[model samples]
Target: MWMKAVLVALLAFALGYLYHTNPMLQNQTLHLITQSIPQSLFSSQHEPNSANLEETISRAWDALITAPTRQWGRIAVGVNACIDVVVSGVNLLQALALDPGYGHDHDVLHSKEDLKETFIHYMERGAAAERFFSDKEVFQRIARAAAEFPGSQVYVGGNAALMGQKLASYPELEVLLCGPVGPKLHELLDDHIVVPPQSLQETDEFHLILEYKAGERWASSQAPQANRFILSHDVSNGEMSTLETFLDSLDEFQPRLVVLSGLHMMEGMGRALWENRIKEFAVAIADVRNEAPIHLELASMTDREYMSIITKEQVLPMVNSIGLNEQELLFLSQAGGGPHSDLHSWSGIPDVGRVSDILLWILEQHGQADPDSEAHLTRIHFHTLAYHVLVTVDGHWRNQRSTVAAGARVASSQACGLQAVDVSKVELKAPLSFYSSFTEPKESLVLDPSNPVTVWQRRNVSFHLSPVLICKQPLRTVGLGDAISAEGLVYSEIVSQLHLD
Candidate 1:
């Protein structure tokens, strides 16, 4: 009888151990990426997969910059910084029920508070993340590194508000690309800014990616048409792995200027993957640039320090090989202004003007490919000039309730199409909202169409819209500038709206 009891106890113990380590059950866990994702997720295989380069780049960017939103879209970063709640909830319950001995000695799972403490420790250990962000050193380093990109332009896209507040000297614009349907929440609510277009063209200049934000449907659908000579694409999380493979397969379509924006709003996990993939792709771009010439511009709303080390340390250095400074390579947080600046609220005319100037400066910078072209890219120049007028209008109509007329008048006057969409006539199978800022704002947005709210509305805001072009146009026509205003306004409005989709 004693021998039989011992044999039974040993068999049960073995069974419990096996059950805990079961591959099938572990595969279903939330941390599967860390445990089961292939080794290739961290590897950089440079063999050109020409057929899927665009998809590959898009996926890589999404994983690195937008993973939080894509993967953990339901969680808030500040209030619910720890991922332990959801991840550990079900696991703890199961452990208690199936294996009573699991937490007996640990005692960490005895009560709710104990379980919470255990979760914090376990999550940190499992994810291998630092307890707190080391912002001071990273920011100082970023500020210093930015100085290297003399005359470089900065563009901000993402959900972090601190980033915008940091870039006091540069220009910044926040763009929301994906809806907050995932486990992460990317919120930067502003009152009124237009969205950009979805179509991208493959041209000799570079590859441009324009992402949409949550809400602002009218603004998002109206972005500028893809340039005939350039390539563009909007990325997502599901496609990240494929994007990595595609980037590795670049044989013919080696883009000289690569622009990645609208990721600050993503969750930590997504951002981590995004940074890693971007670092890998940066090397690939560098390899191509070595054979030719390439310039890469990454627009971000997160603080320089918050971004993945791959981008802050690795990717930027790779781009600098041909000598583009960190500022030109990555959009510093300051460019987007401060935490007070929301994507929904109207930005001040000065802020708008500053961003336009920066855009022109960026577009005008002569890349390694165009060594002698001192003139700014004509299209980008026109866009910059037109954006100036849009900002002025935004400032002028900041306090107005019914902004359609103001938007239309500005669009008509500036020759840019800026119009509000009739929500009654719109189709929204997936009506979602997402936001990014230089500084993380309090409750970036509230998606209650019945109340129709923006971050600006909740925060109380105002802005000025002014349109101006600093650089000399190819044709020095005076009145032509005013005449072009209306068209520019319409174009800018449309482009802005495109981002809202």
Candidate 2:
């Protein structure tokens, strides 16, 4: 017994010494702890109850519709040349009392004919048209108006302008609408072509979103609570000229930042078109990088399957930053070969450490895969219902500046949340009640300079984890992604840049 005890003590001491001395072992230990955090610290019980969700949604809706549009109007006035792409059609929605059949959770079914049939059935069942606006027109008008204040240019292309006539709200901001416009759109826009529209066979189709509530229901005949379904037709053609037009605008305008969205285009057009578009855009952005420092950001990526392709082909090559929600992050991580891909749901909030670890792993994998890639991502932002996590490539932003930017982003997102429910005149400040139960004060993690685990050692990465203002019940979830992305970018990029200037 005495001999065994001595052997055990020596073994333990040796292992401890090795762990302390070896950076790789230390990182592995840290990885294990972080990997366990989600299951241990965050559990399903933390999810908001159905009643709370309903109430929150109701209140948010009431506040949103009644809120004044001028609040956003002010935001629109501050930005410069916000360009978006592809199909920006109206969203037709219906809140279903029925269950979401089987195998449909956050799953988008893409069938125009099937969606049309569903739309007709829902209309017959008393569903209503929630709101209608052309994404191209709305985004263009707002961005153009905002850019006018800065005396900049806003160029909107893709299928967004394919069906609509060019309308410039502000002369100072040239709203150049490019894309194939059919005879129907030609007639509607009264042939007011700012740039001659490319001839395409069809216009973009409207998106239909069906939302469902919660119940313990399953694949069985038992009905689901309420759920949402979205349907949008694909209009992502990989033609070189289409991309050339967009690149031409980039070359001419030479804007500081460019925002790319419309991931849904992949569903209809297949991965081929998606890949071509990304590669083309990435090459174009790289070629023009020497002329001006252009920042590229991608948003509204609902589909996870294409994330790996986008990350490797587009993001690593040229894109500077990428923003995604928790679920999207989970999917991307899983698809991109991260260990924690098996999470059942994102309802339970993850802590800062766990979130950071996952993001670092992703960055490490991507960086190692293509060390020769021209552009290295400067930031990876993951926004959840409860909090926001930002991982900046070393030296991107100072700690204090990042914290302030994060707080400002939180405030802006909260306002957009209220606006999502149709609340008019969003207050500049976030209400105290908006803070989530899982949220604490913003936490910062400065990577150790001497012992870094990430593959890229050129700079120390900084992570800022900020809690979000909670809305117990949210009336609408449709535009929340867009709102969050738009507001956060405006605050971090536009507002902060302006303040600095």
Candidate 3:
């Protein structure tokens, strides 16, 4: 009787407090009441069917800047930031007992149901997408509910912020972050990452990622690939406010590498608003020194005009390097009128043949593929669940063997959330022997477990293919892409830099 009375008293107080105070964080408060989930909720690990790439992975780890460069390099990554809450996607859906309907289309989340339905709509196809939400109360209820999961976590999230943090991990690198880092975010960022004074905003919004593993099933849909579905509920990042002060300070830093991302946040904000912000981004990008290289990290975009504007008139052509996953690659190809213009959604793993065609088109048309081309694009890094490829204009990049391996290693380690990859939780899914290009299979290159990084060239462009050790139980998937791109960029030696011999 006493325990029941205590429970009643606690429930009454919680109701009264929520009725009067903040409802956005109600999930954070209620998680303490429910029993935490047990380890059994996660799936069992898998051992490799064939010999795993342990020896190759170790060599890559050992080569992790084995000789830390004596010369320091400065890098800048920015233009958006938000709080992130990550939870086991399948488990959370089960907890809700929600059979989210497929094909729900809405640019902005109208209510809690809209959020769920839209999430499943994309999840069914294993596409990476982000939808903006203005219904604060509805989003709050849903976000807080997801956070109630026992293992749910929060971090400073967004392409710019997360990539900046990843870059700070490298030695002899000065990392400057351009994104919102108010008092609350300041504590979450790495102490080494420099947050300028102008990039300040109140932390009212949080991005929720329902992360799942490969082959994880949800109702009738089975995820063909390991990926994330993001929901953005931030007015600050959606407006591209972080870049406001970034332009004024660009010359002060004079970074060797300038990274621009999160422009997709402006999508769904009415064309007038996003169009103007794109101009601002172009201005900020054009300010880089002629010698330094700039990279644009692509995101999932739904608006066709937004994507068309990217390749047709604006930002993509200004940067020399870019990083994107399969889904984003397909979307860009369609919008740019490349090979796969008919694809509106994907049902399974993206075909390697189609991916090569698009990457080649981007290089030949928009990138620096032509000998006398004034266009700046020279590098493209494409990542997938089973593999990663780094393509660059020949003679513009070096250290392919080690740089490509480093990218593959981070993809495994980051997604599994392991300090170092624990082979017990992983298996090699990448083919031991495969065709290097889309051309008629003349012959396939065999992968030796001991020496796994594959290098082949196509005319003037160079290709480095590194297979990933698939993680059976992915602990986190939100920032794995950013981490992979950062690793590849750090280990790379770009041209136009004077190196001490």
Q: What lDDT would each prediction earn against the true structure?
A: 0.25, 0.39, 0.72
lDDT of 3 at 299: 81
- As a TM-score, model 3 comes out at 0.83
TM-scores across all candidates? 0.25, 0.51, 0.83
The residue-by-residue lDDT of candidate 1 on 1-501, one tens digit each, is: 465456546644754564467623321232233234332222224313312222232233222221111111111101011001111222332333422122211211223333324333322221111111123343233223332333322222221111111111112332222211122212222322211122111211111111111111221122121110001121332123223333333333332222222233222234556565555554665554443222222222334443435334444334321111112222332333322222332221123223333332332332112334432122221222222212121211222211212222222222222132222222211111222122234222212222221223211122222212112111111112222321222222211112123
Winning model by lDDT: 3
lDDT of 2 by residue, 130-217 (tens): 2112244433343333333322222232323411211222222233334444444334432333443333335433333443322322
Per-residue lDDT tens digits for candidate 3, residues 236-347, read 7788887767766567877777887887888867788988778877776776636467888988787877988878664777788899988788888788787766877554
- For model 1, how many clashes? 115
Count of backbone clashes, every candidate in sequence = 115, 25, 0
- All-Cα superposition RMSD per candidate: 28.1, 14.8, 16.5
Candidate 2, which segments miss by more than 4 Å at Cα? 1-100, 105-204, 212-228, 236-242, 271-278, 291-305, 344-347, 367-374, 398-459, 493-501
Give me the runs in candidate 3 sitting further than 4 Å from their true place: 1-72, 90-97, 103-108, 289-291, 344-347, 439-443, 498-501
lDDT: worst 10-residue window of model 2: 73-82
Candidate 1 — which residues are off by over 4 angstroms?
A: 1-239, 253-272, 291-300, 308-311, 314-347, 351-501
In angstroms, how far off is 386's CA in candidate 2?
A: 1.0
